[model samples]
Target chain A: MAEYVRLKPEPGRTVSDQLYQLGLEFPCGGCSACGGCRVRLVDGEIPITEGMREALREDELAAGWRLACQADAAVPVTLDIEQWSARILTDNTSVAFEPGEGFGAVMDLGTTTLVVELVDLATGDIRGVLAGLNPQGRHGSDVMSRIEFDLREPGVLCEHIRGALGAMLAEVAQGREVKEVLLCGNTAMHHLFCGESVEPLSHVPFSSPALGARTFAGSELGWKAEVVTFLPCVGGFVGSDLLAGLVACGMAESAEVMALMDLGTNGEIALGGRDGILCASTAAGPAFEGGRIRMGMRAGDGAIDRVEATEADAMRCHVLGGGEARGICGSGLVDAAAVGLALGMIAVSGRLNNAPLRLDGAVQLSQADIRELQLAKGAIAAGLEILRRQLPVEPDVVRTIHLAGAFGNYVRVESARRIGLLPSWKAPVAPVGNSAVRGARLLLLNPSRREAMIEAALRRTRHVDLGGDAEFQEAFIENMRFMPPGR
Target chain B: MADLETLRQAIIDGDAKTAGAVAREAVAAEMDALTVIQQYMVPAMDEVGRRYECEEFFVPELLLSARAMKAALEPIRPLLAASGAKPAGKVVIGTVKGDLHDIGKNLVASLLEGGGFEVIDLGADVSPQKFIDAVQSTGANIVALSALLTVTMPSIKMTIEALKAAGVRDKVKVMVGGAPLTQQFADQVGADAYSENATAAVTAARRLVAAG
Candidate 1:
């Protein structure tokens, strides 16, 4: 167990402000939407705020659980705030990266996050890692918003991403000879960073204008790397990131039918094996990223990233960066939905039992929140069904579900199954940790790996367009319910 | 004789099998097909439409009720044709260029059929010229255009302008719809009418058809 610290609240500000001013890590960014920072009252009782009422269950509210963002400690209430821990997906399970001359790096350009990792070229050792929230988030949370911005003004996002990478490069390089950098992102990010016009991607049938690999010198980004090579996009919204994931998992050559699902703001599903692969991407929206939820945020310090319910219906939580609960982040939202289902608080139609699922009368899941989850999960479930139907493989025959992306890596499989986020199946889940980044790293370390990915993108895989499929439309409406469509 | 009350109740309950069987029985029993429709089937859909307008009935509920009504109407279709029963109106509908989504378009078509109109669904990804050709061929009184994407919504105005250029603008009523379309946008596009949802589309179609 981590040590709990007792701290006095500064005059009148909420507990969240006190922590923020203290320069402590609170992932909620002090947004009331994510009760990410919560400090429990160990001594005197503090009246719960309205926002807190929705986040905490009945027992939690009674037991002195209070939102650090919502509850202001007028009198220094002895607070029990646990220290933080981050469950980052740092496991490099892909074919080990062998070293080279001086050094190299791999970057995962996520819509919401930017992660840069510096590696020792000779020994294949990860020297240092830097992660920063994607600076382009000021425009919007999802890729679609970024696309709109691109349409309004060309080359704006390209500058933003290029500059951000440049800053990151400066920090990691430290005047060392960083020979090459491998980058992988979704179709939109891939286009923006490479200075490609996003005219084609802004509309439907998202055809990438310049999907081929491109190399940019360090001078281009005003950084230290000699060259940065972007991975090629496969098709449609299925970009180089997915190709990277496919490379990391080594999915193309397997004899047995397998599936890879990357759960994120957009859900990309692939079903294939020795037979040609079929991939599709659905706009699952930013529900998993804390977008469009009453109480949602990215997984950060003080965020409720895991949740459980007792036989007596009391709610318990596992917060990321384990301190007092700040707010429910993406992983926590999935857990709450699962736990809510278990307690019969969320109905099959995704309707809440009555009001929101109240955790200590401080945290609640509103009816609208359940609907948003339904729409988001429904799109993914439908997309998967479409891919399976187009292919010869049955769900039972697909022996493994390779869950990719940071959301897929950290999310509990049982929770995913409970919410129908992942298909209801008995197949073993292989948590391929941030397969895109891993794939990028693999490509950076080895030339054969790069060749394999390019071959798969050009020859072995077919991108299935489900936009107008009747079966997919029917499945989408049916999957909108909490229950599986077939049932 | 088959009971009209049973026919109406089947439609309201969304039971297609029961609705079809009862409708077939009524037609075989020498009941006037138009009489059965005016008295029971139409009234049943009217109730569903009312509930839908009031938000008591949602999309799924509205769809189920429409399906049941169609089941009953299918048995009466040939009989009404023999009797020279006129459709309430003729409508041609399609989602505009670059917008392949069909949910809203399909809903409006089903609701139009429930409202006693003939709808020729052009499916999705339809162009302005295609809409013009359809209007010229079908001699439709109303043209329903849908576009879900803000970028694609301009196609609706193009279709309307195409009608004017073809000198058939006065012949048909233009109804523009989709999620991104607002009344102001619809008016700016020179559409005769705008609807927020499929249920409202039914009402707007009826108003346009009646005005003529």
Candidate 2:
């Protein structure tokens, strides 16, 4: 899950300072904890500090392993960045759209990742794709952290993300004229990118006044597109990404009630049909995406992406690129937890019988890791339950569930059900990859559908604030147990 | 005596139904309700706290034990109050303004209650004025503030400033605790003390009340 990069460190700046622009992640916020920002001295010397001694083992230090946040290279050096070549989900489903004039671009600006795709506006064809870790990650990993970061240093994240995304847009529109550009992200990203205040979002009853659609001339954002627009957000934590997901899945225009869930750090859920749409956001921490767990990383080279209980007593794992497993990602974590539950290695109470169930080389599920997943999956499960009760029809009327986002798309439905992460609904579950970008692509191709769909989404959607809900507490605690679905 | 012992074990095991049943049996038998809570339930919660501190239990286990202790205390509450048993102390508690997270705050409140404190829980997103008002009205000597987010950590200081503004700063001991909190932060915010976790919060509250 690492790649080498040559850098000439500034005399005073640390290694994190010089390489942060390269989307290098410091999962522990570069506090020299977690040892996640480790870099090997490929060609030059990195002086080992006390932090390296504490975080790295004896053999690891002897092999030139150093914490990037602690050590700096005096001269030009090639150091291997541990979190590189991330597998961002850009494979979107096809949609019919009205032909437009020329080329266009669509971007799904996530809190952790950025994806930009160039599209042939007249033919509905994807020309090129560019994806990277959102550089704002260096500030903080989640939305709440980003808000806190922005509160301290106002508008820095905004300017940083805008600059990063503008570069992506420019690269996506290389020389060829892009008629217009469409972008969609969660409410935090939407607000940060549009230069709106995150003050209201940082408090109780978290909703913002500036969630409406924002438009700017492409040149104004240092890009060459004719028009650039970031989509509007639904109320509360339900961001425009879920709105775009609704559009992509055609939920609001459907006959039967369906559910769309984007299981990111902020797990957003929407339930409705042609009648109406109900959305609520649950603070599902980054457990699903391998945040906070020891030996956790993004789905990249050498990350364990899948796991299975081959027999009752044995476990097996599949790494991403067929090498030694450096870390485990969300999908693999779900599978491991499910497998643990099946084998009775992990109790329903999230206790590890043999504490720290080793999955692959250096990757193990600790007791704390199980608790984190419980908290995360509990939030999502409870959110779904709360939204289901509010539906006009029967509680079990949801016919299908459209699992959006990379985690949802890549996660195994059977494993999710086994751990009660997903309910045992009598319906088909479909993982529509990158629905936000696909919805944005739809809007880019057919501008005529934009105003009406946005209006409908705004008018018909009811945001349920889980914080204020009375039943939410009980539901969340109950869902925290890793029971079989429907039990 | 056997019922009280069963209640104690049930609380430690996080068996709410068993704890509640034992508590009801003790109440029906007219056992001293205050003695049941002061000696058994409190000690049971302390054992749960010890287990949590040593990593033998996690948050779920702590919360489960809290819930069970709450169940055991339910039927004993009225009897203890009717007998005119004074609580250890009155404490006002809430998550600070701009922070909606209340799980950790609720845990502290539950543990405080189990420790025989008359907890006036104001819930999350509580403003500074609310704390001052609770202190003035309830005559509570301790105010506990919780903030989960780093952005809302300043609210703890602001709440303290409001207490000072209202001229009740000296009258009440302010305690702060959360995930991102530290002793340095408590000192910076002019708090009387800072506890790292819910169990320590009980000890801190007891010390703060005992100091006066």
Top of the candidates by TM-score: 2
Residues A49-128 of candidate 2 have per-residue lDDT tens digits of 88789999999998878887777767777775433322212242323467877888888898888988788877676655
Expressed as tens digits, the lDDT of each residue in B1-212 for candidate 2 is: 34678888899899999999999988988998888887899999999999887657777778889999999889999998899999999999999998878888999999999888999999988988889989999999899999998778989999999999999999999999998899999999899999999999999999998999
Report the poorest 10 consecutive residues by lDDT, candidate 2 chain A. A85-94
Docking quality class, candidate 1: acceptable
DockQ of each: 0.35, 0.34
| Tens digit per residue, CA lDDT, model 1, B1-212 | 79889889888777888899999999899789988988888889888888666544555566678888889989899999999999989999999887788987998998899788999999998988888899999999999999876667767888888889998889999998997789999989888999988878888998998899
Q: How many pairs collide in each candidate, listed in order?
A: 29, 0
- Estimate the TM-score for candidate 2: 0.84
Where model 2 places Cα greater than 4 Å from the true spot, the runs are A1-96, A392-395, B82-84
Tens digit per residue, CA lDDT, model 1, A1-487: 1113334556666655655443234434344455555656677656787777877777888887777665566565555543222111235244445557788888888888887877666765455556777888897777767877877888888888888977887776667778889888888888888888777876567676688778888787887888888878888878888887777666776677778898877678888875778999888988887778887777776677778887778778776654666567777888898888888877765757666676532556777777778778888998988888888667788888888765765677888788888887657988775777666766777765567656864577888887878888888877776673344
TM-score of every prediction relative to native: 0.80, 0.84
